[model samples]
Target: MFAVSGGGRGDGSWPGARWREAIALTLETSTIDNTDNLEPTPEPLHAGAPVRPDSPTFAELGVHPDIVRALNEVGIERTFAIQELTLPLALAGEDVIGQARTGTGKTLGFGVPLLQRLRPASADAENASRDVPQALVVVPTRELCVQVTRDLADAGRHLGARVTAIYGGRPYEPQVASLQRGVDIVVGTPGRLLDLAEQRHLVLGRINALVLDEADEMLDLGFLPDVERILRMLPEQRQTMLFSATMPGPIITLSRTFLTQPTHIRAEESDASAIHERTRQFVYRAHALDKVELLAKTLQADQRGLTMIFTRTKRTAQRVADDLADRGFAVGAVHGDLGQGAREQALRAFRSGKVDVLVATDVAARGIDVIDVTHVVNYQCPEDAKTYIHRIGRTGRAGKEGVAVTLVDWDDVPRWKLISDELDLGVDNPVETYSTSEHLFADLGIPAHANGTLPKAARTRVGLDAEHLEDDGRSGRDRRGAPSGRRERSGSSRSGSGRSGSVRSGSGGSSGRGEDSRGGPDVADPATDIAAPRANRPPRQRRRRRAGALVGEPATDERIGSAEAHQSPVPELAGQGETTRRPRRRRRNGGASASSQANQTVDTQDAAAS
Candidate 1:
């Protein structure tokens, strides 16, 4: 049996006495069963059944009353399976390895305990004066960083716990300034967090708790080295927690090396499928060129709200979004090719109901948790089963039913079969379907008369342009359609040192440097000094000279028509005190002629005489 005593202050007036009493009673009565009998597997704590009326609330789990109140205010009273298993061990300062499927409320599972253990800024004078973070949560992607920061901030609002998010693609000045102002918890990606820590801007020496969320994703993205470096910098006595959906080999080794006697908890049953049972999935064989037409009809399905379309490449994501928007559908795109401001703008538009369709690539869509998503469409076949699971996991979240459709081209049929076999999806050979196919309409609940374009009456939602893009303080070169990296030649004057020389600008022309009224070098105004047109300029003349004297008239003259007049003069060679022209050699039957030899002998004699 495990037990934890809870109290906020040392004055003996227990602030969480009711919750502690409830936790003690539950721990005493409940019998925790070890579901997995495999050797080397830690005893797993199961929540038994899904969340119900009799499920334990945050208060009953001995969570801080302030956190419980904040969670209740947001209509989150009962704990999910993962949260129920994690809260007790984590709140007691024990290291925990939490494994759960996506959208199983993993953020709050660690967030609540992390917030409860930390001393809030308003309450702790010593820690507040130091302005060092008490807890750190590291995520793999920028999207996840934002999501976790928002969740933790909402959960710790009543406790006055300051939370800040730090990630790449945004200006560093703002994040550094936020850290300087002090925060109770910091949630960030590995790259940006390590950069700040190496620069001495972030202080991790005083951290009391550390969490690596999405551990498997971090390993896949090759962030384990930076994560390990960060872990080494923290105090050794602090508590560590790791949460991931899948446990690969590297993650298991990581848990063994860093975590101390950690309790392994799996929220779901052992025999359960990796995919959420509530999600309804369908697969179809589609053509490469007809994919857009097929996806358009899928978006028009009955009762479809906030659909997400996934593509394999960044170009395809943007292309699908453009095609949909051209067909009068409100759509936005999130991919690697877009600027950070544009990506955030698309997500904001999608979340605010401004855009009903969002097109995104795999990496860009990581950690996006948008509720109310009724449909997820795979515009192209996924690479493997894991990607397929992650893609469909976006829908069917939080115990909601969702519809997922996959369109596989002829070339990707083999890949799709492999994924189907791995997951036991039983859809090995997909039905060959097209935009006009009757079964597609029946499967996804599309109207019988639906076409490739959206109707005028259904285009009521505002488009992506309606969302105001925030200025991320990036240079114009970072924006799309902006000028290249080369600086443009402007008419603005530039001051130079007091010297007399031609000051050449980047326009490939020399600007005359003259004295101004103040006796300083005058800068040229490019706007007023436009070059003359070629037609109006005088024709250039060419003259021939030999032996330091003009030998022929201007070559442009009509009188100079003979071949001899057009011949080039021999160049004069400088001797000791005389100049002699070298005679030209003539090849006659691949040998020197008698006249050429005689001219050469005369030139040599002339040089010897000088």
Candidate 2:
């Protein structure tokens, strides 16, 4: 295997220059599998070449006839530049490091070869367990995992390759059962894949080929450790392929450590801008409050089909989606805050044309492959150049002409300028624009009379609700019914303990603090026997105290009849017709003797009693 790196070096460097340089130097000096002398290095494949009638076909590149037939059935007759360059080497079981911008057909660049290399289930030995997957693809996000699985399944349909997607957010039972039924290729996220592998539900011992798509994203999400752990679990003798839009330091280190004599193939020229040339990009400095209004107008642009609005936060994604939906635009949202089922539901709605607009965070920027996305609106400025490319790359896919609009708030102007400078966007200082701006109308082909709210006649597509949300059987709370109005007591009741005396039903009923609905104190009924009779009740007791000393004698129950009896000078006797006074102890340090004080107290009590 040989490495091919060709590109013009511009003044401005790529985002991760240090790592890129390191990779370039390593590729120059090292020989992959000591095969550098076996074959001459081929010419570099430039991405500038679009698929035309004269371009190489999948079959010419030694692709399996069954897989080629599947692609032809779907109208995919030609290979993109990345696919054209990657297919030949990958089919030979060589470790490949594919670096290409987003939306450049990287999925099939690796997927087609992966499917071709896997043995069909029907061809497996009779004694070999069909449950062991022969090929595995690890992605960063669940949406991407699903998309890859779908694409692979479509390409491998003629070959009868069972492609299953295993990821989090849904029930594990379904995935476990899918594995048990036998799978030829597995596409999943790191966490869920590791979970099943550790639990013995997923078998990786026989995996002959592995692909790590979006390796940089895995690093950004702190999933590198988990990816490493998964790598260690796999068999040492395997064909590994790592693909990413950008290569960071850790990703470079990971590639060096894990990949053996990998061919580093870059589709584009070294100095070529990562942004797609077919996508018309526009940047505007606008007020944060006016972004939604501007977005509504942008969505109303003529020929806008399946527009996407991206925000920096999940709340903003949901807010923008809600605002657009309120304006009568069919819109759905995808973000981290949403459950896996909801995310998939929104994605399905967007793909099925049920919703023409999708509001999402950066999570959707990586693996969401929609060919008909005519426009992408950055509702909030992206953090950096790499994100901006990924965000806008959703459009202008497969040589399709598209538009990208970036709305930068005042606070994000500095951040946007950094991105612009890095990507050579040239719009460091964006023109101040608003919803009613004349230039905005002309640029996006918005009708001169268009307004912020979508007219009733134009609202034809079904909304997000029209798409059915699949029951993953995990979210019981969402399927649960409203709580009953009646309240039930579970234990025995206690009286005079500051607890609720009675259990009431319905609204505006008595409260636990003994207050009625009208805020008045609740009075017990005299005719109704809510408590036991006085004759049947036990006697109440109180300890008598003289000055500071206890008398060690109990008082009668009658003494507790009224509040004033306890405050009166005469103390009630415990027995019938009996009055007793205990002798007082002497005071340690006092002006008045304890005996004198006690005697005076008894005299005052007797006088009061008389």
Candidate 3:
């Protein structure tokens, strides 16, 4: 077995075993009240010592002149500690493992070398003629894939490098088409990239550089198997780079297996300077039912621009968005239940200031780097310290100040305690808080007379309805209403009779709560249900009413007429001759058929007369 190594803390303990034990112990101690504020707090990034004037520039760090010029044009003159340390070694084409906190410019640490190694001048003319990928960057989420792809494209604009981002929640055709046209770099999530490779749409045989971005988060998400399969497909002699926020044992094992004599580099903020020093954190004990009211009150605080609220599940995300919208807040929701189009729309609206508030699930919020996010509210307590860090990291980015507010319900007190202990966020026992609590106003700087209601003057400039989102990332066939060139043949041909039929479910019907937020096959996005428009398919179902209740639903009074219902029967149309419809019996047998009921009533009356 490979020799087990601890994270640079030099404790000499097996990192994976230690991490697992820590989680187990934290969970066990959840019910027990332990010491609070036991750990000293670190300084924020801003309070750290300034960078030296002699710090290396992109040009001094072996970056190409064109890349240097592009960086200069973008106002990025000096490199961060991680970039300065990793660039020279990376430029030398060595396997590298980079460890740093989030928002520390990890992308450029590996991305620059990945692009430099793919230069046409470095390869023969004949070899450069083929349109195939020379570099591969794997991330854990589509949001990260898009981000990495955009950054690389911007940096390589003068170099003529073509980057393609592939992920799920999109049709396969656009990706396949992009692959056919040939791309220089392939940035994608695990599952979609693997699918294209297995289907022969993506060729990885010639990749010169392989970068695994956010490797720890990838492992946490159980993408290890897919990562292994992908690594096996690449050439053995390729340069590899692994970057993660933390050095867990599993990530170390992965790096050992993948990297050939890799250089280990860790460039973290000063020990006294915490990665999250710029963010103010507030933890409050809250009642589950009253949390919404508390959230509304918080949103109404002064200078609360671009707030992001994170929930544990998609159901909560939608419910929160709906509740906020009901109160006239410009809100949008990103979750698994939304289609790719809807997800993208929500993100765009949030970014464009059309929607000031974005409610999202943990998975949906991954790799979302939105600057100017003044506050992050955890609608539900996070499951772990890493999750808590990521949720709060959304705010206080780009060297700006931010606030993170967490409302922990009684049931989640233990979980919150574990997170607080791990992160050393000194909320030993959060003060009990309600919507009307005076502490809420004083802590977050809300107006003394502020109610839980949002006023028209407080609304953002635009709402989600005003924005028009175009869904180009998805394939033509699956683009909802968009036309496509190649049509997908789902199965063997079958015909259906065109008939007018009642909906599967009536409007305002309740749905079964069995489906979780991650969305399995059974849980279809009703808004983008492509099957609805098919010629032979049955009429679209009512909003959510079950099929069985349509014709048999009981009324308060059984004999109520059209006048009592405040409606009249349909009149004969011009095209069709006069047709009269009869009122049918509600049920059969016990609730007898209409004809049987009429005959029985006459027989009973005759017997009574006799």
Candidate 4:
């Protein structure tokens, strides 16, 4: 027989019944908030209290003393505040959500604990090269992946805990081969991590602990979905630690969903005091093209040890790099288009001081953990408030104050205004100026003429004279009638033809030859006049008119005679025969004017009678 109730008195008041009821209530709350039932609240931050180490001896933390000696050999004396707080919780197998900025030494904070729980990876397991990784650390950028992987490998050198990093923009075959052998710990960006997982080259089922470094930046890059999917693929019993600069709502929600009773650790507010107080902030409004000039001047003025110039696009980053290179500066550009090998080369060059300046896009800027960057210049305004903060956060790290200069274009005023408002920077209307303005020199703390220092002899002290440049770029009179410094003449006299014809400088008859019958040189034939006027009237009406008309002669039949006949004579030729022709008297028909209509009718009647 089935018995559902635990009460002997047929009522639900028995202790056993109460126990059942309590279990049900706990399950209900667990559904609402998993943290409520699984873990205890985290410890609060103490300003002056000295934090204890996770263990008294290396053996106690499950690491050999030789490994501890290796750490000491590298000049690591004491643990950072985040390491102190997170190590104990992470080692105990409890989930942890840590809030801390970059350069706080959080890598070892989560890394050391993950290494403590790892079993000697199998020799034949996929990706298990003699000392390859079993632990996986997902970072936001390829740079961070390489950095964190290197740090972890150094920390595990004595333990022979092999580490490898997998990321995009590189060949996948090598990564696949590495996985085929085996790795003790794997650090990579979310995209490559998922790709390896999906390809069956890497497996998360055996990963005992998973660390998501720079969780905020991962979210910013729209990597949360990939992070969530990766979490689902891991064993439910695995340890999860999330580290980020800030604890926003999404971080909290993530903690609730993936982490099982995570211990929240945040450094004392004073921890951030050194960074905030030391860094100097400046904002200015200028044209987009002027940013290059301003950046040049600022770089010359500051002479900082290392500088990182951040831009919004890869094209701009390349352009800034090219401009600086042309000006004889040692510069490099990092963007998505470069192969992984090329990108690493540039980063290495910049880090080793072979390159003085690094121009990079947002993807390259975020997650960059360079230690000595003294200045960060936003060559172009960022997209949003978060990006603005992240861009400047690159410098002013590791407890040293740094300088941040932002160049805001006119079109980006509204976006910059929002970011400035949020940060309380009071730069709503940043100094409206230009690159060549005197204020630019003063603001950048440079001489007014930073253009170039030319020697006296090279200055070419000359004055302008009344010399005109001709069409051939010579300075003399243009008597050949070609285009000169004056505005090129338009609307040629040669109609419907190229400008190869000459102008009529003098008056003449048909061929500029005199004619006996028509009086002066024969009027230029209407069809033969090359420079004939282009008026709308018929050509016949435009022919030159005679000085005197024969009485009663129709004007159309007589035609117009040359006006220059009496004024000039054709030059005589020695061998030419001159023909003397008699002038013919013309029989003329007259046309009456409109005012003489009645007289015209009488004349016509008389003619008819005759």
Query: How would you encode candidate 1's per-residue C-alpha lDDT over 316-386 as one tens digit per residue?
Result: 88677767776878887777666555667677778778788888899888777776788999998999988
lDDT of each: 0.71, 0.69, 0.68, 0.59
Candidate 4 residue lDDT tens string, 240-300: 8888877677866786688775555664223234434656777888887677777777776
For every model in order, what is the number of clashing pairs?
Answer: 0, 1, 4, 17
Model 1 poorest 10 in a row by lDDT: 492-501
Candidate 4 vs. true structure, TM-score: 0.61
lDDT tens readout by residue for model 2, 111-167: 988888877555667415555899999999877787677777777878888889888
Residue 112 of model 3, lDDT score:
82
RMSD of 1: 13.8
Could you arrange the candidates by lDDT from highest to lowest? 1, 2, 3, 4
- Alpha carbon RMSD to native, model 4: 24.3
> What is the lDDT, from 0 to 100, of the residue 122 in candidate 2?
51
Judge candidate 1 at residue 85 and give its lDDT. Answer: 76
- lDDT (10s digit) by residue, model 3, range 98-146: 7766566667778788878885834656446657799999998767777
Measured by lDDT, the strongest candidate is 1
lDDT of 1 at 197: 97
